[model samples]
Target: MLADGLSLAKMNCFSRKLRRTAPELGSSKNELVPSKLPRINGWSWPLHGFQVVGWLVYIYLAIVSFGIYIPLLPPPWNHVVHALMGIIFILHFIAHIAALTIDPAEAGVRAKQSYSSPVPLFDRSKQSHVIQDLHCYLCNIRVGPKVKHCAACNKCVDGFDHHCKWLNTCVGGRNYWCFFVALTSATLGVLLLAIVILFIFIQHYLDPNCLRTAPQYAGIQGNTTWLVFLPLAPVKTSSAGLLIVAFGTLMLSITCLMMFAHLMAFHFYLFYKGISTYDHIKMRRSKESNIEAGKPPDVKTNNKAPKFLQT
Candidate 1:
């Protein structure tokens, strides 16, 4: 009984500290949850399955890079590019998984006051029934400013950004940096994979014997891709090289790699503007409001340039 009481006391003290220290999110309460805030959600079994697929793809990349491609190439292709790419990209992937588990901010909460309960006269605890400053209607806790209630997680997060279906978590506050790093590294890494695959596949054809046949058919060295893009001709189809090329490059090109590219570009624009995606939407709404009110919309085109040159 005594041990449980002590544990409860400690928890209460920690909760008090959080409430006392947490800052306000915004000037107004209603403005807390902006639209399209981080699609980032928390961990779940479904996300675990999603990330597993990414890992499988990465492992396949490694097999294609080291196990299949390098052996076919000359001494020049045996450099440390593959190793470096794996290290950097793997580190970022790990960072993303780690970031997903972290809470952007912790809100403070305490039990509601009960007037019928008598206070202990002998014990001089610092205070009684101290509630948090900002209360979350959803979470039933006091959250700091920038903290918004995540409907998916059913918790009020500090600096609640967005719920990411990929990570299955809300990417908020300091966690966003790691998430961005993950995106950048993953995108670049996939791009590197595409480049490497193209180089190796093209290099294979550079072998003079590749196209020149034994007088049965016309020799074709240059890309006959213009003839038709689909059902890639069985040129060297017997070689494992073709299979690896198709699997590692083509599969990723259509899926993870391409999606990462476009997603990175979108986030880059958001970061350059120094605003969250939600904030961009808010700006658009404000501009529309101005238009509706018959006010001349501020006509500054959001050109991507240095602040000094922008002026």
Candidate 2:
């Protein structure tokens, strides 16, 4: 009877130990599996600051262009100019939204993984490269030849372009078209605004009466210059107000135009070469590294002609 009782006690003790260790083992397993997807959006202070500054500049330019400059123009030209600007603005805004929101993650990562089933943890100790045999160690999946891991986004992007700090997103296969559209529209809009402002500046000096031909200015005297804040409220002022605003708009527009134009040109060059921004950057870096190593630059391979040219 004592033996039976002692055996029962030992069994109960063993069961208790098993229960404790089972929970520990389960917890460890859970720790190994990631519970959430890697962050794809760039949520940083610089992104927020860029967004704020961009909006402020856009608003200021819009208000001045639509409220003051456009009104100063005569007749049908004013209406036509307003419609054109509105279209360009809409295109730019829509393209920006699309580019910013689209998921540029690699096909396998997007299709196979989610918050509930996150990518498996990569064991770098056993591997030399993050990518081997077209399989990504970090993403733990097979990726395309052009797939690249964006450190900022913490995911692999298919046809990986460059991460745009302004948009706060990765530009890849999915969003590259939208990004290009946004770039093009923004460039056009700023260039148009600059040209209109320049025209207004010339009219302000040479033919001031031509600018005051709007219905609102019909009763106002020629010498009584006015600064129109809103359509309904035209504040009487000297030439200084109009000139100051015109000069400021011109300066901003010129600066933005220069930047956008350069970016557009660079992208066009990449497109003509049938390569992405990432590829161009990588090739350039390889050339520099070779130069540093005192090796002859492999121009034929590094800067190969496009397929069309080769054909």
Find the candidate with the highest lDDT and give its number.
2
RMSD of each: 14.7, 7.6
Please give the RMSD of candidate 2 to the true structure.
7.6
Model 2 misplaced stretches (Cα beyond 4 Å): 1-37, 42-48, 115-129, 222-224, 229-238, 299-311
Q: After superposition, how far is residue 56 of candidate 2 from its true place, in Å?
A: 2.6
Model 2 whole-model lDDT (C-alpha atoms) = 0.75
Q: So what's the TM-score on candidate 1?
A: 0.58
Q: Name the candidate that leads on TM-score.
A: 2
- Judge candidate 1 at residue 33 and give its lDDT: 37
The residue-by-residue lDDT of candidate 2 on 48-133, one tens digit each, is 66766776887888888887888777778888998999999899988988887788988888887673444544322332245656
Candidate 1's residue-wise lDDT over 1-311, tens digit each? 99999999999999999876643543332323322222223454345566667667777766655554433334344456646676866787688777776656443521332222322221112211112356554334556655654544444556555766667777777588888888887777767666666665666567623322223224434443211111222223344545556565656755777798888888889879887754565566666666877877774345322221110
